[model samples]
Target: VSLSLALKGFGAWAPTIGWCAHQTQTCILLWAVSRLRPKLCWDKHRIKEMLSYGLGVSASGWVWYLKTLINPLIVGRFAGETAVGQIALAIRMLEVLSFAKAATYRISIAALAQLQSDGKRLKQAISEGMELQLLALGPILVLASWIGPIVFPLMFGEEWIPAMSIFPLLGVTYLTNAAFNLHCSTLYVLRRNWEVTAFHAAYVILFGILAFFLVPHSGIAGYAWAEVLSIVTYVVAHLSIHRLIGSPNYQIAAIWWAGFTIAMFSYQLGWWVVGGLGLAFLLPEARNRLTTYLKHFRALKTG
Candidate 1:
């Protein structure tokens, strides 16, 4: 609200100040809310433990900022803003598909945290979470595939038509990223930050090297593929590590993923409907776990 009003008032002459005004108002509101709720308390020992885990989480953020920044930095430096704009456009379009992924990442900790700290529960949560994410993300991607080409040019005009080439690969990247989110969250729940941190660092380094070669060769298309490839690497790394640590049947989600893709490309709603029913028989336990996860989320939300 403040942002919109400030942009209206000062945007014509000094647009940068608009965000500054908005941020000031936002901070004041946040401060007021914190005061009303009053969450923090002084406990030195507990604070010390919290700070250590918080720093691990904070370290992952720095790794992410660097990981996502490298390719665009390379693209902007070599290929110019037009390429940057196309990359941004493709990613922005893809972000819509991550809605369920983002929400699950944010909210499922409470449920997963409650599941008795046993192998069966942990494995159930991890594997079923993957299936639920596949179900959530796949239909939307298929739906978007039907409309995106037609909608892209109309929505943003013909200048962005070239970006459509990069769209599918970016969709794949976001699919892989959704899995990455769950794995990262699972790792956080399990207090396995050492390996997670190491993997993030390695991913960024490997992604930078791939981008160095890719962006120069195939322009934005190559860079998009690099992102996809690196994301696949992250997923594989997590799957392997997850298995080594505990969850043995992590690859089970691949069947659903393949089915979803095939049904999507086949463009068969009946097949999807049948597939939805089939999941109940094939993975009834998983369906139940997902139901429980959602009910837990709803309880948390309404509370």
Candidate 2:
């Protein structure tokens, strides 16, 4: 709320001001709510122990942040500012659509860390996380894709229509991200930070290479396709997690993901949106899963 209001008032300076205000507010709230305080003393052994773990997490984070730079540095060089803008618009839309993934990611790390020692419980947690994420994200994605063509021009201006071409493809990318995000969190909770780091490194490298080769020829759509294709590499994370704590129940999640992807693409392709929606929402298994989740939510609320 502060950020939005700041944007309205401060315009370009809003981010810096809003971020400072937000952080200050968070600090104050934490200070008020928590009993913890900073100590003036430190232990060398504990410091070293923390650095050993913290360094790996920080390394993975830095590598992940490199992804944000690839498009501007690579795509801008190859495709020009217009193409970069289109891809940016698509990515921004995707980020908004991926709110559920972002929220679950933070929670999963803590929750899965507790279950890391038990393979059965860990697997169940991961499966439930994926299901709940998809259930929350799927309909919103479908609705956005359905209305985007009509709304994008009106909202962001007609100049950004090219972004619509690749929005669904990037939607697929985020959908996959939402589904498998827990696997990444699982690796982190298990203290396999380097493994996650390796995955991030590989993804950045693959995306860069794909953009370098494809963007010059295919433009922004090429960039979007690169995103979609690079997500296939998440198979590496899946394999890593399987070796650690077995695999989650991907069967149902896969059905919904596929249907959502097709539905998003249907706007670009043809009338396949009907088939996609049917597959996602109408399947007996899909319906049953939805009902199960709803009941679970209601039970929790009522209980």
Top candidate, metric TM-score:
2
Q: Candidate 2 on 1-303: residue-level lDDT in tens?
A: 557867579776777777788899999999888978877988999999899999998999999889888679878998899888888888888888788779889988988878878999999988878888887887888788889999889998988999887888888878888888888898988899999998888888898889788888998877888877899688888888888888789978888887777887765578867676686777898789889999999999999
Residue-level lDDT tens digits of model 1 in 1-303: 446655667555454666677789888999898787656689999999999888888787688679668646898887888998898877877776777888888887667667636757766676767777876787687567657778889999999987876776777666666655667777777776666777788778777888888898888987877776776457545664466456535454665565444444332244454465356336765556557768978999999
Candidate 2 local Cα displacement, residue 281, angstroms = 3.7
lDDT for model 2: 0.85
Distance from true location, Cα of 207 in model 1, Å:
1.6
For model 1 the TM-score comes to: 0.76
Residues forming the 10-long window of minimal summed lDDT in candidate 2: 265-274
Evaluate all candidate structures by whole-model CA lDDT and list the values in order.
0.70, 0.85
TM-score against truth, every candidate: 0.76, 0.91
Question: Which stretches of model 2 miss by more than 4 angstroms?
Answer: 1-14
Q: What C-alpha lDDT, on a 0 to 100 scale, does residue 303 get in candidate 1?
A: 100
